[model samples]
Target chain A: MKPGPFTYHDPTELADAVALIGAHENARALAGGQSLVPMMNFRYAMPDHLIDLNGVSGLSFIDCGERIRLGAMTRQRDVEFSSDLQHAVPILREALLNVGHRQTRNRGTIGGSICNLDPSAEMPAIMLLHDAELTAQSTRGVRKIPMNKFALGFMTTSLEPDELLTEISFARWGKGHGYGFHEYARRHGDFAICSAGVLIEADSRGEVARIAIVVGGLGATPVRLSAFEAAAKGHRLADELIAEAAAAASRMDALSDAHFSADYRRHLAGVLTRRAMKSAFERIGVAAYV
Target chain B: MSVNGRTYERDVEPRMLLVDFLRQDLDLTGTHAGCEHGVCGACTVLVNGRSLRSCLMFAVQANGASVETIEGLANADGSLSILQECFHDHHGLQCGFCTPGMLMTLTEHLRENATPDEQELRVVLTGNLCRCTGYQAIVEAGLDAARRMRAKKEAAE
Candidate 1:
């Protein structure tokens, strides 16, 4: 398979890259090319102009300051190996391990995964869990979009044609926050059939002070269990509460694919949510009910 | 791109894959093209010391990058590298279609991790699909190669 003929532009400056994509019609920015290149080879995507972003400066930094800031072009492998990130957000590394194989992760970019917005992609689900803020730049200027409002539909993002995702930043959970990311896939590197991400902060009394739960691969976008999170806040993490949250996750509308039925996905959502919550609870040194 | 310790300058189509450039343009046929998509890691090579799927990258994208391919894995005397030798010793291949990729992938892996556990090697190999050998022999070859490389490093030190 070969990609269709397209003029390629390698821009070293962010402004130049933004201007080129904005100036050309049917232009697509090439991030790590782990996903887009394969689509190009299959002729599923035939952009008339390919704007390569690898040479662009200031798009590959990992600033673990007050907020965890990641440049759009930051490689998944880099994120997986970042000790700072591992300390700040261990769940990210756990999810990233399942994103793809080592070879793909070496070249795959977080920005690409987020902009592609695959329903089963781990990066988007992690961003959703962290409430990440994405910065988009274009000739028109820059704007910040919350991760919750980033994805419009399956493989579709709220980004304009010319806008490029520059950075993703989010506030880190407090120290000792319990986190768990669980997914069930046929193979190790395969996309998850159903995935769950959970983050919990425990109060002094070993009660749940705050919690965030996001289930992916069940619908067009990751479903955030905000209602469950709110209800469970300030309550002890009991088995019944976890079951209730899992039940709520199972009842959410899920997409049915050829291999997996909606019912099966719903069932998996419940099972994985329970497992993820239990793992999160255990991380907080709480004796979760077995 | 500088490939196999030699730098080559050429003009190519923007959409030409790095694998195609290596095989067709540079005549480096050792890098096989299995699944042209990113799934099969048959076209894996080291770009700037990091293993990446050549099929997933365009030739234009590799400009000014140092690439190490299967052709570069051999000794200067035309003999097999330690990894290839371990592959032969372990029967790591049957049809040999996926050997190049497995070698390149492990070459980088061993360089980074002088000693990798069996589970770690298995996880590292999940990217490259080897349908012929069922991966057991390949895993054994990888372990052997790692042990030999570690010994060599220790001896040199």
Candidate 2:
């Protein structure tokens, strides 16, 4: 099945796009058309109007200065292979590669992924781990929203009808930090049934500075395990610490879908957490090679 | 609109998918639609030199875009392109549904890299799925095509 009849408009300016969507409450903004088009075909969603953001170029850049700024329309493929992201935020690069296959990554935009707000998305988990900020634009003006507050519920977000995600910005991964994402899915290009992203910062002498363990594919939005991170702080990636964090994650209300039960998700959460930490440890070892 | 170096103009519904517009409307059925939901790569096509899921795009959206489908790869003499020949020689296709998309994707890479390693070939052919042949033959075919294309180009130079 294909989408129902609709009018298509390619707006050049961001402001113009906002105006178009604001004028028609039922209109849908087409970012990458990855999630939207699929639903439209099966009649899951039927918007009468579609406003394309492709004409408004220059949204595919990743700027690095005091902070890392990623344009909303940046394709996942670009992020996956970007030397800038590889150097500045290796976790994000890792997350992007594990998104979909190469073709989907080439067409899937970051804004689309965040706006879709899939609970199992890898990049969102990384965002939660780093406390990233999302910038949204509307005719009213631009406003920044914390990643935690951006997603409200399953496939739901705080985005207003008139607003569109314009950019995502975050502090570059702190120096002397090991970042990693680990997840498991039924297939190589499929969404994760359980996923976790970790950020472990170390001091000059290799003493622990701070750490964050955020898990996705577990709730309506990505959740950070501050308690687990705090428990592991000042400690190394020993088996005991990994087990403690794993136990902590196992106690959270992990999501249960048709693919996985809550109990199984909880179990995988602990396993994935341990694996993510192990990956981080290896990443720390190979930092000098890269 | 100009497609594959030829001009084609036709009326289509604004909501009509590009793959449908090609296969049903324009009668270019070489572009297959496998999942229709964009999960399957059967509806792959080149839009302005970039590979895209035609199932996810509206025909109207491709108004001024340059499109190249599997049918467009043949020459005036109706001979198969080097990539197509390699697919036959290497036993790459089975079930035949995924062949066109695979060929289109493989050709694009061959045209660019001319010759690619096995790993590179596998990466470029990732989205196009084949239920049969175990993908080993497909990668071999892609490599075979790329090597021959590179030789032809070098010989011409």
Candidate 3:
């Protein structure tokens, strides 16, 4: 299906792009056009103007320093293949592989995925895991938002019509931090039915010094299992401890759809939480206490 | 737009998808459009040398960009390219609906990782869905093409 007619604006400068979108009431920024284009084709999104960011300069970059920063227009495939990201934040790379296929990732951008805020998107869940900082730019000025507060609901973000997500930054994990990402879909490269991402750091005693688990595709937005994290924190890695955490995680409310019942997703939430935690612990080179 | 090494400039509507622009305006019908929402990879093309779903892009979005479609997969002398020949030699295609997309996708994949094992080849082929041949022949064809391309490069050097 063809999309509705709209004026296309290709702004060569970031300022010009912002100004263009700010001036139009129903204008939408075009990042990778992976999600928005499909929605527009179906007339689900009927923007009167399209502000294409591809022509905007200086918005596609990956910088790794004290904190990792990714420009909004950076493609997912670029992140997947980046040696810097692979070294500094391997979890992001691992999660990115579970996104769409190579062709889609070749065109999908990090900003697009985050801004679209699909309940099952990997980038948002990864952001939740790292407490990633997001920068939004508009004609007014710039506002920094924590990733947790960025997405308001399903397929909805806190981004104002006049604003564009400019950059995302996350702290580099310290040494000995291990990350695990796992998602269950009907087929390879499909959207997850239930997904889990775990980050663990062992203290001197090799117990669970710090842990964060974020689950996606089972709720209106990516959910941070804080209760589960708190339950497992400072506890020795053991089957019983993991089960307790998983059970707490499963108790959280999740969405139910035609494909998966709520009970099934809840079950998956528990199973995936356990698996991700185990995988993360293994990466840290520690055996789970039987 | 410079498509298949030929430059053509035409005013297009923002609503017009690249696949439509290719088929209707440019008459480059080799690039098939299937499942316009991007689930099926039949509308795949190379935008600036990277594989992209043409169906998911507006024609205007591709303005001033270089696009390579299935029409350019043949040699200038009109013979099949090595990848295409491998498909024919290995019976990679049955109904031929997904052949073009498969070709464009593998063309990009083989360029990056010249030699992919069978498992890796299957992983790469997951993007393009072929209804026939059960994917075994397609994987074989992709592996065979990678070998031939590597050999050709080695011979040239």
Among residues 3 or more apart in sequence or in different chains, the pairs in candidate 2 whose N, CA or C atoms overlap within 3 Å are none
Quality of candidate 3's docking, in CAPRI categories?
medium
Candidate 1 vs 2: which has more lDDT: 1
True contacts kept of each: 0.87, 0.62, 0.74
Candidate 3 stretches with Cα past 4 Å from truth are none
Candidate 3, B1-88: lDDT as tens digits: 9999999999877789999999999988989988898888998999999998999888888888999999999999999999999999
Clashing pairs for predicted structure model 3, backbone only: none
lDDT of 1 at B139: 96
lDDT of each: 0.93, 0.82, 0.89
Worst 10 residues of 1 chain A by lDDT: A281-290
What fraction of the reference structure's interface contacts does model 3 contain? 0.74
TM-score of the candidate numbered 3? 0.97
Docking class for model 1 is: high
* Count: clashes, candidate 2: 0
Error of 3 at B67 (Å): 1.3
